[model samples]
Target: MTPTDPGQQGPLVEPVPGAPAAVATLHDERALVIADYHAGYEAGLRIERGVDVPSKAESRRERLLSLLERTSVGRLIVCGDLMHSIGDPGGAERGELEVLFESLPSKLSVTLVKGNHDGAIGAWLEGCEIVPGSGTRVADVGVCHGHTWPAREVLESRVVCLGHEHPCVRLEDEVGGSRVEPAWLRGRLEPAAFRGRDEYAGLEWLEGDPARTGSRPVESPAIVVLPAFNELVGGTWINVAGQSFLAPFLPAGIARGEAYLLDGTRLGPYRSV
Candidate 1:
């Protein structure tokens, strides 16, 4: 389960004395990037439909904090969608975020990149640093939430990290049983990469040769599609065949990328692509 690329170091998880697991970095120092937290999503669902799901925000926060403490990362960059509301922060969402933030060690710095779900949270996030879709460069890497392709100007950066569509892949055990696990996929963009591919046909914007004049390639920027930090359990699997919505997000023509299975104490990379 070691990575094929010698340059690719660290499984998704690494050990820290008091924390159960920490998301390791492929590149970067004193920084950790995570996406699609969707804070207060359950409460939002309840308000919208009166569904009765148990509140799990506190536990999720504890897990995130444990990772943060374990990594001892000086900075935490949320690619986008810190809250699940389309426009404004709901009472529950706000309260949960408040609790989560308050629980963080004062030594840590937090940054939020606005995703499609962060529409009106700006007012609520008065003093916190917020980056719009334009994105930010950290340790020579570009980061954004992957709801839409970045403008050509922004894509010029060397590495792009993002989140939005929570990416997962189904894995079959030795006995033929299956389970869905969160995955990280990486691919290199080539000319006309997704042409004729049914999974990517619907994404007309991604079909043509990126090198062609006026066609900007939406490549995976050392991209890291994080598991949903919230309790909701649906995601797009990159390993499946056919027209996957995630096809356009990865490097063109690659049906799947290497898989890093994250167990509580150990993270191992299994070559799947």
Candidate 2:
């Protein structure tokens, strides 16, 4: 059985603008959800990559604060990759994250859903709740950083949210002008195929009225892959010929999914392009 959490009952889910990127909000729980902050990315820019830019952790924190102020939400859920490095948190990485948290409201709760790059991130996130890299349930939605198979709780949710692929669409005009835009990928689960997966084998879909008897049981779920929140982060050009979805659960169905700009334009299924 999927372990029950006290916070995963009812939720009002929607997308909200969170500055350079967007955040998913669960209105019922007063939470703002974001993914892939990649806190130490600036170091890579300045040192390894030989870019002249100085660290801008303070500026990023300010932008995040502005989004929080606009929404007035009490919970911040980072759906993974809070740090860029795939190893331990270094002093620079730790310091920047501390500054990020110090600027936030003291009353707000933060949850970190571990992503592939979030190794030892818990050391940097002192007071926040840390869930497994697999996933965690919040307000009836299953959210993960999209590397490994999510725990059963997340698998059984009506809506499953993912982040790691940093999904984007590459577009070229007939005259050769091209642009790549970070985007959301929305798609449906193929029930027969989804049921065949080892991870979801015996799990049953149990939503709807408990008092009513003999209602038909159902399967299939809507999958939503979020764009990377940091504008600096690169993306997977999903529609390109050799490009592919990264998450294990996504490879089978991602080609059938439609991409959407943050502004909400439907760009059609990835495979069709």
* Model 2 TM-score, 2 decimals: 0.84
lDDT of 2 by residue, 101-149 (tens): 8888999899899988888777657879999878987856788888887
lDDT of each: 0.60, 0.72
* Best model number under lDDT: 2
Residue 114, model 1: Cα distance from true site in angstroms:
1.1
The superposed Cα distance between candidate 2 and the true structure at residue 190, in angstroms, equals 2.9
lDDT of 1 by residue, 1-273 (tens): 221122343343232323212333435555666777888888877888898788789888988987887677877778788888887787888888888888888877787888888897778664357988646765445667767654343344344556665756677888999987665544333325435545435443445455665767454323344555554846676566762554243444332345544432222232342
Task: In model 1, state the lDDT of residue 185.
Answer: 44
- Against the hidden reference, what TM-scores do the models get? 0.71, 0.84
lDDT value for model 2: 0.72
Query: What stretches of model 2 exceed 4 Å from their correct place?
Result: 1-11, 17-28, 46-48, 205-219, 254-256
